[model samples]
Target: MKNILLIIIGTIMLLSCQRDDTEQIRIKTKELISTHFMGNGVQWSAYPHGDTENGEWGKLMTSEKWEMNFKRLDYMKPKLFRVLDQANWRYMVGFDSDGEPILDFHTPEVKAVEKILSYAQKNNITVLFGEWGTPYKMHDLDAGNSDKFKGANDPKWIRSIVAYLDYLIVKKGYTCIKYYNLVNEPNGDWASTKGDFEEWAEGVRMLTAALREKGLDKYISVAGPDAVTRYDNPNSTYSGAGWVRETAKQLDEMVGIYEVHDYTEYDLVRSGGFKKYHGDIAQLMAHTNKQIIFGELGFSRNGVENQERASRDLYACEDSQFDVFKFSYGVDMADAVIQSMNAGYSGAAAWALDDAMHTCGDLGNKNELKRWGMWNSLGTELCQNPADENMRPWFYSWSLLCRYFPSGCSVVKTDSTGIEGLRLTAGVYNDDITVAIVNNSGVDNTISLNIPTHKQLKKFLYFDGDRAVDVNRFPIPVEEKIDAKHSIELTMPASSFVILTSLDY
Candidate 1:
């Protein structure tokens, strides 16, 4: 009788412990966010200054390097690609004595652009291509030129832009170039527009008229205002959100898409402040019937400190972020994407794909290269460190997002965890669902996902010491198959990102 009582008591204690463990899990239900999840991707640009004489892209374009990079891009399966360029870099050489706007479409620079467009064309990638700004007056190469290019309003500039688009779409057959952005970050005082809304609007008007005249309007439409938010000087007169509102009001007819740039602070994202802040912008643009995308997205943790550190430790550029080297950067970026999607952003393109794409101030000096990319393609040539070419940790999380967040899927928001630094965003397409959960806090949290799916899910995890990758550095599923019929419960490790998707890669 004593042995029987002891066995029963021990069994009861075990059952109680199991029940207690089950009760401790944090349960949250997924809610409908938006049925208009346009897409998600990264900014990929042509390398005009990448040569030994100019910068790092020449080496990256080699057969071997190109193959390696394209393979990785293929695996990522990016849906949207933002490609920005300058006039002088590709076709526009200079104006004639008569100022007829000299142009050449068969230059080596144009060929380099074709390489990018070819890939997008073949892979069916939606490309948002544009010039950096009013190309002539912005650069030192044209400082002494007699051309009086009136920013974007210049007739010559408008004609040149339209002609370039015509050549790409009508001649080269790259229908993949669906949208054209006139100026990048027109709201910033640093941009060519000098934050002049009237000037930018006039430019947009002129470009639209010219596109119609050249019959290129049918092929591509304008995307704006490509303005950056938050990082703008506090005392600045206009904010990025202000620019979007203005664009929607003033150029509603001409604009095909509404977009903005964000280089948010780490706290803003991890604390769930970004969603509320940008959510207002998304709400404001909802009535427009066009999609809003984050044209350029990056993390700017302690902006001044990161800038100072980038100058002191790595490259000597004033406009660079070194946090891309940290694993936590990936966690924060994943959080940003989740928040953006939940906030009604149809799509977002992460700041960049390769460090070799740009130099500080567009100076073309290899030493002043921007350090905000997944990897420096010129690591071997410019930095003399082959290891610099290796993929940074952030690529793991970002790739999963790009690969899994297919275009045209509905992005669903979940009920807030009420747990600081934890976020969830789900993509639902037909009967398939891909859910991403991010925990940017210091401690682990038990999460019971109340998603409506019973299909087998492939789980991919990103954490400091828990990530598993193949020899190619691509993510390997932690679990090849897990039943998701009932509520899915799992422990989200600290500073980690977890993706549970019903779709196979």
Candidate 2:
């Protein structure tokens, strides 16, 4: 009888300890980083090919296809519309050999610009008019003289650009234009020397003064240096953060916004030194008051993973397989955005909104060239014929950020442990809290977000090798409510993107 009672007591104690362990939960606290975000923006560069039938823009401007694209854009709710002033063929449409006043806006590109501006105005999106380079006339004495180009610092170039801006805003009545980027990637070829930066600054000052004289200054602000390469490289005199600092010191308030294009595939978060890069850039905030924006960002089409093989099974022309490589590309891009914002950037823009119908560059041309569009503008030659304007996996991947932490939401910091190969970004939409997790590891994960036990886990969406789908819509529930101990567990698939929200707003 004594032995029987001892055995029973031991078993009871074991059961009780097990119960206590189950009741214990992980607790996490998150705090806000910023009060507001400047909203998401996209470029309206040559979206549709210039060609008539298959091209996306000009010929199909009024067609059902174009309408569908805009409908999709409307869903994204883009805050800023960066417009390209230079079109495919020439510097501008109206330049003549006689050097007459060049205000003619009759070409397809000009018409496209007008249409885009009108659409943006209707949607209340700010327009950032950007010039890719000096006009052909300003650079070349004759139309075909590529070698006879004058440098960007020339006074004649400045005057001509200002004249063009005056024509676009004051003369043509594009009153909706809000921002102006003087030249895209000037450090690449246009302006290199510290003196050159000063010249560029002077040009901006003259241009703003001209616009103010025309009474359009109130409508348009200026952003500059549009450096294409890294702005923080120490070895190079004209590249990296050193270059940006020198340029900013020269420009001062001539330009209120400092911008750059990031085509960084080599330096990714996975490489382990990306945080230091952001930290270095953030250090620049101490010197200048200019708001920094990564205006254009994308990974190379011929990415480091692999690109030599041809994709056999998919739609359109044969190209690289849309599997892990594309998935990784999207994941890396998400990290760049997160890090950029975390480092105090105002906002970031994807390199492009849509991929082109045809391959662009000669040297880099392939059967299915990488034009860096969110959607693949596949031609009608492949298995899924007439896929001229179909969305790619990236469209879904990017929508994760667009859907959850929208513009005006405040960024927050979250603490966690035991989660590997995962990046979490949180934002507060008034009283509602949103947490986004991007999982790059090849294994599925069960995450326990430590928060208030009283709050209910409202909704969630996830994307893994697919478009973002609502978790609640699935047969199985993916999000669990916080238990009495204040722990909410979530199961995230490998290479997935998840967004979780609290029930109460």
Candidate 3:
């Protein structure tokens, strides 16, 4: 009886030791994914999404507010920016006596554009500038509009927009406008093209010809098809992936860069389904020699229901996600970024930079502001709450990504450790390296990262209660210098991520 009791105790001890060892051992193998890391950033539109009557954009542009916002942007260090605008907002005013479009480059709206572009120019940021849709129309079925531009393909619209591009790129010397997106999400019925692929293609061709004719093609190339995924149209069966494949097959030559938008659900991102979903699309454009990017990336929980709930809670627009207020959104978004980089996407721009940039219907109503921004710049004027203007939790993780995974960095992938909901992506820029690890599972994970670099790394943690922020709300490194010559082991808490970078600042 004594011998049997001792043997049982020894077996239990051995099993417990094995279990602990298994929990502590997670060796990740790093591999080179791509040498070209185009960039990562946010959609920073010119002018507020609402009208100027509400003082949305105006208040945000004030000396004090502008300086504060500039400081935040400076710290984020975004290398790619998408500036989407409406035609009537800036140069396109009205048609002339002969029905020709009238252009004005000196309006306040244009000045707002200059503010955005000037910063992009100064900071070497790649600007993907574009129009939302047709100048004065949302849906094709709408009537009572006197705008002469028939559709995106309208010869008049194409010529007018190209002239506007000439003023900015050639005349104003804002050479940072590297690509021009003709229309936003032409695959959707809500767009002016009304999911008419041929119509949108014709417009793209016309715009491309106009750019070439005006010699602007040398400076800026056309980027499309700016489609979005999971767009449910009861009347049509078209999908964003279908749009991309067709664009690759049909409008291959006219397009310089292929791009799309995705508002994925939490399960897709957390379960690593986003990698396969995006990888299939990335494969479509592989032969084109031009890189593909997510022009607008975001999250929506249960689609319209989730957005409506967010609207009720915030008393804002209906098409926004409440998850932006949660730390989980940051973890999920980081997961998406990891998947995107691993899936062969060149880059991704977050849905928006500020909630003040748009309203639900562009009606200028303060109450209708979209709630998908890093922060609301006009929160004080619109929501009467200054706290709404502060950076949300996602900014910590995202800004770390934007600052460290800069343009021209080589994106490195890693072999999976068979750990559910744990992901790793690295970027190497010359001697500097940035490694991001995200744990999306409900349980904690102990990961051993094997990165082959001798540089000292700055570790930034974005857990629920452990985020370190400075006075400016920018992410401060938890550890200033972590020696990365050997394997680095750390515990990644549930719904959290960590960034290890050699680049400081």
Model 2 superposed RMSD (Cα): 6.7
Model 1 clashing residue pairs (backbone): 50-55, 50-56, 50-57, 50-58
TM per prediction: 0.91, 0.75, 0.91
2 or 3: which has the higher TM-score?
A: 3
Q: Per-residue error at 481 for model 2, in Å?
A: 8.7
Which digits, one per residue and each the tens of the lDDT, describe model 2 over residues 156-259?
A: 55555566667667777677677787766655543222224545565677777766776666767777666664544333355555546666676656666767
User: How would you encode candidate 3's per-residue C-alpha lDDT over 161-228 as one tens digit per residue?
Assistant: 88888899989999999998887888888887888888888998888888888888889888898888
Q: Which segments of candidate 3 are over 4 A away from where they belong?
A: 1-31, 49-60, 139-147, 232-238, 301-308
* Reference-based TM-score, model 2: 0.75
Clashes of each: 4, 9, 3
lDDT for 93 in candidate 2 is 43
lDDT of 1 by residue, 1-505 (tens): 9999999999999999976554333322345666656688899887767632343344455767667679889888898999998887788876788867799998777887888899999988889999888876666765666256768788888888888888889998999998988888888777788787788889899899888888888988999988886545344455767777778887889998888898887778878899999989877667787888998999763477777787685554767778888899889889999889888888889988888888877767777888888887778877888998999999999999988888878886565676788788889887788889999999998877666776788999997988999989889898557787666777888999998888875
What clash pairs does model 3 have?
Answer: 49-357, 51-364, 153-203
Superposed on all Cα atoms, the candidates' RMSDs to the truth, in angstroms, are: 5.0, 6.7, 3.8
